[model samples]
Target: MSRTSVPPRRARTALLAAGALVLAGLGAVSVMQSPASAAGLQCSVGYSVNDWGGGFTANVSVTNAGTTAIDGWALTYAYSGNQTLTSGWSANWTQSGKNVTVTNLDWNKTLAPGGSTSFGGNFNYSGTNTAPTAFAVNGTPCNGGTSTGSPTPTPTDSTSPSPSPSTSTPPATGDLVDNPYVGAGVYVDPEWSAKAAAEPSGTKISNQPTAVWLDRIAAINGANGSMGLRAHLDEAVKQAAGKPLVVQLVIYDLPGRDCSALASNGELGPTDIDRYEHEYIDPIATILSDPAYKDLRIVNTIEPDSLPNLVTNVSPRPTATPACDVMKANGNYVTGVGYALAHLGGVGNVYNYLDAGHHGWIGWDDNFAPTAQLMHQAATTSGATVDDVQGVIANTANYGATTEPYFTIDDTVNGTSVRQSKWVDWNRYVDEQTYAQAFRTAMVTAGFNSSVGALIDTSRNGWGGANRPTGPAAKTTLDGYVDGSRTDRRFHLGNWCNQSGAGIGERPKAAPAVGIDAYVWVKPPGQSDGASSAIANDEGKGFDRMCDPTYTGNVRNGNSMSGALPNAPLAGHWFSAQFQELLKNAYPAL
Candidate 1:
């Protein structure tokens, strides 16, 4: 559940004249439009396209020019050449014949004066792909021409005001837009590709799902340009061509990472906070901020397993080490996270989600409030507002079921009376959905914008029929029978490293719940959490007793189970056996 590797690491248009051109070619053509005159409103549209041989990607921006605001608006346009719509984002796109219309989603319906919103579409094209010519907003033409309507009269101030200096303050509400950058494409890691290719055809791991992880060890080692952060990015961009590149980067490598567990030990020491900022964070930020990557939509999960430990396991847990105290005393966790939030958060297209750990870690009352306060303070210290972050991510690299079928946290089962046990306390009784919603409410109450969304790591929380019980057993006892009967229970809450009997959870989806933004595979399915024991390797990960099947779980580490996983590889490395198991036991029978 912790990482320690390190390495590596836009639009448009104008009234066709004053706006800048972003990309030019068959691959992408983007133009920004200047203000056009409409009687009651002045509006402009910026258009951009990403072309890939038979198909292309297009994004359009609608800007309001006049001083008055509109509650709703619709855009209408027609393709000039042989182009057909495939899919679109941020708006509802529909076509009849050659014309296409885009309407706003519920969240993005309102626009303030001088405000703008962007939508993108993927299209199929033939030999020639020409930009659309005519565009209209709410029936008003945006062809760099004036509209016919009676203009609103300007009002004059009655009283003279004394001259004084004005100070700019942050907006009362943060940006309400969901992760604006969109495309279905995910950046496939070259290493993962190689691994998959090496496997024989028809093998389970030959087509396993994989993701890219940026940890502390890789960053520190890769900073000097020897190991290739830029190279990986360049390759991903090339593979994406003109398509949207969805890259997942874990901004880990804090000084005292994994304070509660030693399996995923990081290379960086607690006192080396400055090195983390310069050698680690700054270089990665520079690579991502590079102009060549303006089209790539980066999803950064900042400091998984780092922040929540500062709340729950830092002080009270006996298994916690001095590293936690050092992190707290020197403000390493907050400052490092804040640095990441400010530096990467400023990137125009990057969507940063600070890790809120799993529901098991922060779902309790004692841990929830403090975690929110920590996140708020981190944002402030980093010189970034809550607006800079997209939202909070829970269950980043943990195995927690998305839902529990038989039980609810309300202490009732099928309308029958049921008593909640101490182990299944109010906090522990919830699933990822309930946990995320409650956490979102708590975070917004702690001063985050109401628009802030939630994300869950559904990579491996699917407990399929094999592990689940056939029928409800006696609920009389809390120890052996209750734990055995519960379908959603984990072998041990603290056992995170290469958990046994785990299955691939829900597939990636967007807006799965009320406050949730997306159900993402933050942790790649096949990658090992850590090795069974310390083995000398270039990956810079160490061994822990937790991954060994022989090592009985203990109360000190909060792992009170019998069996630990056996034969797992180092953290972030490919484990073919584990991959096969995941595929065989996949939830929804993937």
Candidate 2:
């Protein structure tokens, strides 16, 4: 399905301040401590502002200092100057004359003792920008308000019956992996740091170093070997200091990397499968298993777009490329992944999540089962057990909706059932949730560990506001009307390189739904998916036609589509324009 393009609206991009600051023109600032508290419920607000001439971006963090947890929270403050809110994130922001109020979202309403959640905003001012002085939480004054009365005590019912003992089993301890990279202690890549500095005052893309992509064995042995993996691990361990330090690593440099596409070609030839195991996988395993870093929890996302290509792109025809023939003959894709899993799985602290191609790819009838079987084979091959894999990740480095609001498992689209559609056919019928659940069931039934979980990369799937549809149109045969009227539809499945209308999906959350472990930003926000055009680089990847905005290429169903996104930089490089667009169109309206 296709739709006529609607130009993205231009507005002040909002940013959430739960972590490192990337305010325009401002260097990294330490978290500001709240002033001395008043006597009532002890709530502190940390305020930070990044000023750029007549405009500035601000982030406020609310900390629960009281002994009890509050079910919901609201904060009110008045700007000292003529500041007007342009946009905000992580909460509902509103203004009454000079006073501005921020309310918590449903998922973040509960504020536990010592726990904190933050909200940010961009604003324009006439003359001066001054931080708000007065702050109140839950109708109580803060930063020095006198107690109005004794603290409210926990409530108890007067005439209620006694509760019965529970028969439910408690969830497994440490079952939920703590993504250390989520809030404050995440690693910051030097490249991201530069990007943030360069584009301060612009829409801040989450350039925080989230993962280290190892594309070649030489990256492990060079002077900056392991692509600074060890240094980041050391930093994470030190920052964690006995706490669970979760570090994400991407094992991407396979021989014939991205076999179906040219954008992410790796250095290794198809014949280097043995070298991949000994030089790349083995050394990474050694680093992870080191006794010093034993406490570190490693969340390894094994190659993106690798296994899926093997299933969909490799051909049985005699005309298949030499690389494809070699890859299939040597079992490089499956065996290489199996070797990494086997080696890494041996480490007690390591948790592996195999990439299940996004809903757009694996949602198809033909792709889902085969992908699951492939994951099962790879996980169990080379001495690796299904236990080596914790779950299958969907929508990795792809733009797929988190939920298809218009359709359910029983729904049909274009005369095809949602559950029975193919990648080329039902690109819009299913979402990540439906696809992940079905894929999980398929993998488990295919001999994978039954306890395997599912993850979705929500870093950039937020298609919000006017771009988001309310429902399918009635009495419409036009592809534009069909595609345009769908509530959760993306711009185009044919274009994956920094999709123009894509926005930030749901924020990182733990176990948001059944069979789902977490909604993670596996692909760090703001990093280029691939170069806009082919350029020479040591990373062993080439330019993909999809990254070129002008190229007319073959899309699904013999349709033709353009491969270009006008302003996107090369994959892995930072693009400010895309970052701004993501924030502006953030799902849930930021």
lDDT of candidate 2 over 1-590, digit per residue (tens): 11112111111112222222223232233323333454457777656565545766565678787787868989998876789886565577898777899998764699888777755566778886655655788877764453323222222243531111000011112333432233424444444455555764432544434566666665543324223455566667776777655676778877677776777678788877755654466556645654456667677889887777667656763223456656766788888888788767666567788998887666666677887888788887766677678777888877788986754555555665544433225543357887887788898788876667778888888888566877765523334444554454444554577777778788766667777877877776777777776677776778877776666665431344553457666676667777776777778675
Give the top-scoring candidate (TM-score). Answer: 1
Cα-based lDDT for every prediction: 0.65, 0.64
Instruction: Write down the TM-score for model 2.
Output: 0.63
Off by over 4 Å in 2: 1-194, 201-209, 218-227, 316-322, 412-429, 470-472, 475-481, 487-491, 555-558
Clashes of each: 23, 11
**How far does residue 447 in candidate 1 sit from its true spot (Å)?**
1.7
